[model samples]
Target: MTKQELKEYYWIRRNITKSEQRLIELETAATKITAQLKNKHDAIMGQGNTSDKVGNTVADMELVRDEMTEQIKRSYAVLAKLEKAIEELPAREGYLIRSRYIELLSWEQIAVDMNYSWKQIHRIHAEALHQLQ
Candidate 1:
């Protein structure tokens, strides 16, 4: 692969990974909020409920919600960076990298489609990183 291809591949991989991780983090936060909500419901049903407990749960859920919103914003930022990086990549490399990384294709599939050896694809990806720097 060419240096341009390598750079495109690296940037695409980075963005995809970042976006995916952010999504996971967002999900985790949502899960925590759900758990807190359930706890709050239980607390309400139970005797000896206090305003302090309810207020604390609401606050925690709000904090988690806010954090999830932030994570979503981060995901959008990653996507934007990915878009800019794609635009900067050489045409051929951009197509291949986007197809393989963003679309999440396996190396064998990308190789077969591109008529490139696996080693060649790896080299292209590596060189792309070097060229990027």
Candidate 2:
């Protein structure tokens, strides 16, 4: 592959990780918002000390949650595309890509898992990228 194409491949591989983190962030925020809405709903209605604004807040949080869900879906699409590229590599190369990037393993860890020396594993990694290129 050309240098630019190789760089794009690497970028896509890394981008999946970034997208996953973003999905997690969206999910966590939605969870927090859901909890806050529930708490406010209970406190307002249960105490018979209700505020109209609390209802508004609940509606707002629901809207936020919906938007977050859409963003999470888009992030998954990005992940799927990256995984497709990785899958195109030879089996061993694919495994290396998945382990190193998707699973976020260290080079030493990958070497251990593959039952190969660290230097050999690094060599294989380079070869894998070359094949894609």
Candidate 3:
């Protein structure tokens, strides 16, 4: 994996998290809309008019939620591959890679966690990237 490929791992993980949140929001909105549709049906029954608008809105939300679900699955697949590559590295390199990319930890935090100086952390990060490649 090149630097860009490693960076992609981070972005993919972030996208998955965002997509999941959006999915939850979509589901909540759909539930609210369904509830409104039910109330409208009860109040407007036999009026010769139905809530086609609300129905369509719920359908659109479902479509978007399904698309987001598929995208999240694909992102997880890619992330798993990237993680496997990182796991193949030596223990220190793997830890450094996971800390920086997967966990989104700052370099200083990683240095503190590993009990290394800032400069030393950078050096290890460089070596870890090389190993990934």
Each candidate's clash count: 2, 1, 0
Clashing pairs in 1: 6-128, 7-128
1-133, model 3: which lDDT tens digit per residue? Answer: 8778787887887888899999999999999989877777866565544667677789999999999999999999888889899989999888988898878899999999999999999999899888777
Q: Using lDDT as the measure, which candidate wins? A: 3
How many residue pairs clash in model 2? 1
Quote each prediction's TM-score: 0.53, 0.58, 0.77
Error of 2 at 60 (Å): 0.7
- Please report how far candidate 1 places residue 129 from its true position, in Å: 3.2
Candidates in order: C-alpha RMSD to true structure: 6.7, 6.4, 2.6
Model 1, 69-109: lDDT tens per residue? 67656656656766677667776666667666667688788
The order of the candidates by TM-score, greatest first, is: 3, 2, 1
Give candidate 1's error at residue 103 in angstroms.
Answer: 2.5
Rank ordering of all candidates by lDDT, starting from the highest: 3, 2, 1
Q: Candidate 2, residues 1-133: lDDT per residue as tens digits?
A: 3334433445665665665666576567657766776777757666653545555555665676577566657656766766677789899988987787667689999999999999999888888878766
**What is the Cα-based lDDT of residue 4 in candidate 3?**
80
